[model samples]
Target chain A: MNITTKLNIVPFVSVDSMMKLVLAIGIEQFLTELARYVEEDFLRWESFDKTARVASHSTEGVIELMPASDGKMYGFKYVNGHPKNMLEGLQTVTAFGVLAEVDSGYPVLLTEMTILTALRTAVTSALAAKYLAPKNARTMAIIGNGAQSEFQALAFKALLGIDRLRLYDIDSTASHKCAANLANMGFDITICASGQEAVEGAEIITTVTADKKYATILTDNMVGSGIHINAVGGDCPGKVELHRDILLRSDIFVEYPPQTRIEGEIQQLADDHPVTELWQVMAGKASGRKNSKQITLFDSVGFATEDFSALRYVYDQLPRTGFYEELDLLADPDEPRDLFGMLLRAKQAAS
Target chain B: MNITTKLNIVPFVSVDSMMKLVLAIGIEQFLTELARYVEEDFLRWESFDKTARVASHSTEGVIELMPASDGKMYGFKYVNGHPKNMLEGLQTVTAFGVLAEVDSGYPVLLTEMTILTALRTAVTSALAAKYLAPKNARTMAIIGNGAQSEFQALAFKALLGIDRLRLYDIDSTASHKCAANLANMGFDITICASGQEAVEGAEIITTVTADKKYATILTDNMVGSGIHINAVGGDCPGKVELHRDILLRSDIFVEYPPQTRIEGEIQQLADDHPVTELWQVMAGKASGRKNSKQITLFDSVGFATEDFSALRYVYDQLPRTGFYEELDLLADPDEPRDLFGMLLRAKQAAS
Candidate 1:
């Protein structure tokens, strides 16, 4: 007679449940906690095994897997960007991630990442600007207002105390949508007509456009001295936002160099070109902004470490509020060696 | 007035449910289809964007993410291994994967890879042996009889017509369980006491041990000349099965070079060691077994392409067989950009 056993499996955290988790935690509180997690991980920058995201591109869009670990826990995110998906009445992006124990390679959590990605990207931008931008930066100039615009606005408010926003979009309704969403969020707003007008007096200029081309949304002439530029949109081959002259003039700070070189604004620059890794700056090994007249550019290409930090933060915080559902994503079998036995029981249960 | 919209979300196939899916698809049919998928993808070996898996390791185990694309479609599998998991009543390995369109990067299919990983490994072994081993190879020696032993035996039978199996395990009860499962399937089996005894006169030899430490399961003296050795279990940094002499005597073939150098049996060899990729062999660009007197060593650590092929196969086969349920994993809102609206609706539903 052959004796077999079973393993325990966890439940999954679907997109709906994730949304509830955020709403339950309250977006404001979530952003504040997220800021701390990102900052903490950024500080311990050397402990992680980091890499640029591995991407597979097609004519329409790209799907990527971003993985990173801090010697103990491992995290990887599956994300896709399909700008054309909106035309088909689908999301411009969708994502999910796994948080696993490095000691055993068992996934402890599996959660939807579409909403989480938005929150993290916004939080990352806010965290970087907190250190790189001007000390009293109160107003931000946002160009290419789209799906990610509102999150950026909210994170800036939550992290940097940026109560004033100047917004511009090629599509006027996008600005209207962003302005309308922040109608009573305790922020002053200016709906500018063009990119030039939007950044005229703003202290920090954030570019989050959705074009897949080499977009010069902010030219050299428009960039003012001492204004820190958060170049967020140009994050891959053939995608960029700043004019070549802006990178030529600014003190460039990047996520991971190899990735930023291929995906961030530095893709426009040469191989031997100089740039600063954001982790190094956070680690105090490198300087951020030297003087008020110096232009500091955080060429944000969305690093795997940021996602790793973000996912870990969500995993820690969501459970505290009792807002997340436990996902049975890993199997805990009764007999460690008898995987086939699990199937036998499932078959019996079905019939 | 703001129109609130919500997408109906559901939990897709989690690791535990994949165990259920394997049973739902029927182990025999799943293996058969898996063999077909593995073969189909191998035939078109040139059409893939392949890379080494990204791994994050701790002292006890490792978690890895593997991503690949064939231009039209994309797939990624997350897998982990821990020899100590079994001591805690957990499986030594677990895996899950996502299949998506390259055009948009949105996953259309997500699956449990624990069962599928076994199936693919077995099918890959059988397929490699088909090209390298004797056409009339009838019997196979199976060492390290664990969760994957049954699949290895069956895949060889289905793909290579090996009707007889000689099985051996350090834990003899594992062999007993394997023989019991195959009692109805009709294969004459020899339950041997040792790896050497298991290999007596078998045309093909399969070594898939679970122990993470270096153990010479099959020494050069045990494996004869002209035998096709499918070394499957000697994966990761510290694990290996065959003696270095076996590799010295055999013609080595691998899935991907850089990965095999780190994880496969070839890790024993030098960095610049010459080996043929299995695809080149399968595509007839390179040779398999050069002569009847030669020993062929397939250093199988598994690859992203095999998972990509297996995932594509699962996605295509599941819908037709009605073996899976629709998972509302992604948000499908009525209005494309109104993800916030979904929250409003969920709030109403809960209230």
Candidate 2:
């Protein structure tokens, strides 16, 4: 088969390919570039067609499809969150995405997004910290030391110059694994025994617990003023991390309010609670951190625009990296209307 | 690589495989089996979670995602319709879909749906006609002789024992092609120059024109009492095939009312228009065709449950036919929480 005969093939980046690409570009640089893409998309937020994710809740977990388009390109991610998947030796969250040309509606790229989701989620948090965190803040606390903890630590180090991490988990083995992963990465890491000890003397805090309910991981007395909290885990209707009193004391910034109010930590608050849109802060229309003593909260539920940016970034890197395989995902007959003829021809070709 | 090492891989069925499967099963038998699946799901329609398709419209065309879940399995299709695409030698519509386990939230099958969409749409039409069309309906007229003409003709032949087809299209070449495709398929076929001539003596009339506007393909004067009309072409907001007077005179049956009222031929009717739900008719809770004098119209805009049934049928045939390839679309590590470690290990393995 000639290469030109397969123009309908879509480029697919598998997990191995994504890992090789990330390692080839250097993980720190990958996070930095991904953060730049997220920031750039947030800067032009109004140009996107945004909608809240369409979710299907089941007894086990939830499966969601997040779709967004910028009129030129279209992208969507299929993701599932099953907290009990870890017991079955599966990742709690796994994802895959497609990017297509809006004009032709033909897919250009399909890639594994389980790894990319972790990278983008961390980069988005770090980018928010750049605008919302206090000036000269370096020490950060991560409450859940699971699959996302190491990425968050690395992204903050790359984007916000945070070199110290205070980590805690219900399972100490997880904290040990995270600490060992970041051992030689030039961070002063301390493995704490409890969540309260992890936030001690920390300037920024990120809570990414794995439970799927409205269980409070942090009380109002634990969160102090002048600290920026990146609430990463409480991102569903009944799932939240911080206490309502803590949210009342802080100014919250979110990706899209319509979506955030449903899936972010602010779901616990009243419907009309005033929260600043993160794009407004990025566009300089709204203040991020009002003062040095102001308690700031980055309610970090993931958004579609961020995935669109990540997909766009991966598509841009495809030419340079060549780390993709083309899959025959579309049917393009010589004469488009004679699809039956194409099928009949296939039978003849096989014979 | 070992076989078990790729356990996380998904089975992908391309267009060629789908065609080979259909041919191997015999086209008529395939349609019969697919119709059985559609009818079975309709019998238990209340068990499925349904939502209206998420559509993104551009100046040229529209792309949509149709998703549905039956508590145990979930499926969605990504489809695009561009009316202007045919001018550039491209398909007016192309589609692909995924089926996943709701418990595990892992995709099991990914298949090209362009050809499958045509087959399933025809099967769905034939299934609806089973309940809605008049008894002993044999001779039928097809208004549009484009891509969907042959399938609709064959499905009716296999399901309803229709032996005669009168086909008409503005483009005579399309009608000739449709006639050519069904030459030896055991049908008494006639090529008509106009829609009025096509429906002259037919008991059932199927209007499936390709125009994306509200140009009336069938006038009120052309339709007679007791004739069952399968309105297939006018499926979007601004697209309709039958005249408003024809719809008002006909007792309409729809797949899903909330969806059909927005995209089906009934979009021209009032929001409070009384229409019978097709599933209720299949479940024997509602009447289909009351009397021979009553004109019955099946406003077939298509629905997610039909796609879900088609995908389920394809999945059941995968193991028997062995017509699929494995795609490593998921990221599964040895230790689920140590995804970063998986990346690190890949670097060492590559070296």
Candidate 3:
């Protein structure tokens, strides 16, 4: 690229381009490669600047800005979670992100994170399950069967070799939709009538429901002793998926404690409730699963570094796939001090 | 716009389009109108949810995310300030912003804010001057004529009717460039040898030097009684333009106290030192320019609401000007829960 193009243009990955790129790479491989990036970042989590997302809470939902930097690169994701949006035929969560250079503070990539978010979230859950889930885990129960359900199934299958699926949703149509989407993908699938029935013989359970209020998608009685819980949907204050008793029984692992305490399942517990940082387990500083009968929970509210990894992954793919368009997002004057002169010249050129 | 377009496409005002839009409406008139919006927002300042900008500081410079919401609409600007960038033929600052609706939590507009920020910062200064500047101020002195200098000159001309200009810069070429950019724009221009020479016999002195250090552009002795000082450049920590003695002599005005205390010229002052909120003066809650001999200083660190006003103004201008392009930034699946299904269809369509 020329100097003007280099300064002025930011490569934007649109929804269409993201879909095309994912399809070109194949979804399972994309998730697998993305998981590696997420795992690598998690292992060195202390190197990043991490903070609870800055959220603007309205009566309807919340809009958040999640920012992270690993000293070399900076990234932020603008995401909105409006559970009611689905009633109006809109996605419950929509997002976009930017990744920039720490040296110049210039954005190198802008991308639609709606699809990428689903992919990263699922891969993160599977990565957690890799250490926490029971050995030779084969069957998984997905209790939401919504937009994130299929990705969860695929990510588990890609990373852990789990090929059995049990799906349940409040609306059976959602379960059907998820199962239909995953058809012929080499998984044994079952659409269950209820969350309890779905987790009957499952070794891992995922609750990915969408609601803005307190929810108990899984109770203590429903969860067995050894099942690893991937709690995906209880990501905001007053929004949770598992029962307090269930959380009390499970060993919770969180991405960031300050954030998870306020927005994750652990919010149901006291402030000093003990939880393990997932990074420590990946770095071998802490143990993941202690025994066959120990229950583990990955309280996944989604952190900024995961999104950073996703952005970095997509930015690296830009040259190989060429699935992005250049956006004229920044002002680049020939002379840096002559911004006003640039305008004057533009006027003169136009006239 | 169709439903799909309404949901997926955000109107993007690029650098090229922003220049075109500004030229379409004369620059003076644009500044005047934009100043009106800034004034209106300031009039209802209590309506906004304000916070000190979120900044990520690097050894070289800083990048910031400034967000504001008035319960109905939310807006944020991503800006980076790197003073060393000019040497590499890059802008000292570059910015872009997003304006989104609160009800649905969907972005309505995404625009390049490099030009818009310059416009809004200048307009905000002029708006503050309307309340605090000495009455009938016709001649203005502008020191450090860099990228922001010409806009500052034009804004003062548009809002305060200060037609006589005295410009000075360490590098005289910048002053000449400022003079040349403003040629035949209804101004009596003079290139002065020093800041003291620039301020001689002028009612208003605007110090807008670009440096990321604690260099005083204006000394206490140079600032006389009855003069209004518009301090614009000392915006971040360790960056101040006016000497502390000049600040002590003047009744200071600021955009937001929490922010201005740390980033504005008043960072040199005690934490509890009295400073007037510009909005209070605009809303008739506080006094401005109590007497002709009393010094007044408008310490502008640039705030989120000003950028909000700028984004709102540009969004309102979209239909009339049609100067923006639609960016497919959001994912809008036909069925909200069938995001995977949408991807499947895309893959099938591509195949």
Candidate 4:
């Protein structure tokens, strides 16, 4: 109720404010609550207008725009992925998003989505695991201990009650950094030497290594029956984390097939390879984990609706947390047709 | 060189800053310089990537994303068109855009585009007229007197030395308002009773009425030879201003053919109807106006690269004018892999 009343002012959540809000609410509770929003949207997934993200790929990296609308409110995220950015001391991914009213076509909220994306991605993985992971699973093996590793560890702990984390990365410092960040966050952490060692006895495997090429982080021999594989890193053309044999043996559940076929782990499989829509499973139209020993792979190439849900959740929290700044992003003349007059008056006032 | 050195800080130009920058540089001079930037991009048009805008249409209005990149710098604009918004005292079109570095996929500038769009649209039209309009033409008629009317009037005067004006709108008050706004700006003005009367004795006719339907502002009979038509308002599917017969008679020129076929005045023409690309003419690869009697129509459905050029121009002005604020839009961690650590530090700092 204390938000900006000016028509031209849009509420903007900066990175600092996002961090404060997340910490204020407690990270696990934020993830748990955000998961509910994501699930609510997934339940009504058929109602959303979905399209594959428009991407501009370059030799250095790719920039993308992901847009979705539920006919009432529309949301879009501007995101970029450059695997080589790490060597330059920058994030491999950075993002921001906007939520607007469809009726008026006016933006209501703009927020930094780098942090929210990590949160939503982890929550989505854990939400899928709730249906596909073995009952009472308490251990999760995260194969890449990069920027997204700790969030995955915490989300699993918050949603699935999985507190045991086995973390591994090609860079050992990244594994140590992940363990250090999750310290006192109720996670029982282990720094593992290899992907094989990490998944030795883990019930859930989350592969989120950041590579722009087809480098298999999960070999067929590393994956076992009844293990839920969350393929997070293999999301774009020529990027894959899991071996083809591993995907062939698993029952893949995807966010959107059209996008997944091009960007998810399923990109390695044949065009006709069957995959269940996760929303159908959530809506009870399709089954998830038919048997205890069935290998369920949530081929998680993140969807725009998930970002929409995250933005909606963040917008709803603005009133309670007061964690946003009003941005003068729109030109609002006193008379809609008098935009030039507004500039002239401003010049006169300055003189 | 005085901008922020912080990696996460992006320079943001709000509406107020945009108005100030435009006024500081003088509107006509600003339009002239921006036209040069736009013309420069058009001259090297083949080197850039182009796509039809991604649009989400609702019964009430439409929201669109226009994106383009020149391999080194990428830009995109978020814009909306809601004709009914005018009845509710809102602008029919509002927009904002971002310019980013393609190498790192990092946004360098974020600015309000509603004002910039108006400037660029006017400049583009005048630039096309330079190639397509009759030499030394003076008198002009603008069919719409809404938010974009004054900008078009000034851009024509600035670029082509046109000082005589004739304006008309369905609402006479809009025309009166436009005339009053341009008062003392060195233009000989006349208010017309109808679109036909507005075009009388005018060398260039600009149709920019803001109706969402296929309402004819210019018919075949009114379009005489040796007149260049700058059609600005018929920029979406099912929204057109010129009569189909007028399109058949004119040598239509467009920004991009793939987009014009769906959203410009050319939409009324046959699929294979001959239309010249404006960039080809600017690049000297094609002819613009073959003779003085040829009827030339520039179907102006705005493009992404124009927004790119405008944003680049504004960004270059920031150092001289100091009219931007550094926004904390991206999350920067001390270690690229320690995003969670950054949050923990934020929490500690807040406490």
Count of residue pairs whose backbone atoms collide, per candidate: 13, 0, 0, 0
Give the per-residue lDDT digits (tens) of candidate 3, residues B66-95. 999999999999999999989989888999
The window of 10 residues in a row where model 3 chain A has the poorest summed lDDT is: A1-10
Candidate 3 lDDT, tens digit per residue, A1-351?
Answer: 222247889999999999999999999999999999999999999999888899999999999999999988999999999999999988889999999888888888889999999999999999999999999999999999989999999999999999999999999999999988999999999999999899999999999999999988998899889989999999999999999999889899999999999999999999999999999999999999999999999999999999999999999888889999999998888899999988999998999
TM-score to native of every candidate shown: 0.93, 0.98, 0.99, 0.99
**Candidate 3 local lDDT, residue A19:** 98
Lowest-lDDT window of 10 residues in candidate 4 chain B? B1-10
Worst 10 residues of 2 chain A by lDDT: A1-10
Per-residue alpha-carbon lDDT of candidate 4 for residues B84-172, written as tens digits (9 for 90 to 100): 99999888999999999999999999999999999999999999999999999999999999999999999999999999999999999
TM-score of 1: 0.93
lDDT winner: 4
Better of 2 and 3 by DockQ: 3
Question: What's the ranking of the predictions by DockQ, best on top?
Answer: 4, 3, 2, 1
Question: Proportion of native contacts in model 2?
Answer: 0.67
**What ranking emerges by TM-score with the best candidate at the front?**
4, 3, 2, 1
In angstroms, the error of model 4 at B262 is 0.7
Question: What docking grade applies to model 2?
Answer: medium
Question: lDDT per model, in order?
Answer: 0.81, 0.90, 0.93, 0.94
* Candidate ordering by lDDT (highest first): 4, 3, 2, 1
DockQ of 3: 0.86
The per-prediction CA RMSD against the true structure, in angstroms, equals 4.1, 2.1, 1.4, 1.0
Candidate 4 has a DockQ of 0.90
For model 4, how does the per-residue alpha-carbon lDDT over A10-115 read when each residue is reduced to its tens digit? 9999999999999999999999999999999999999999999999999978999999999999999999999999999988999999999999899999999999
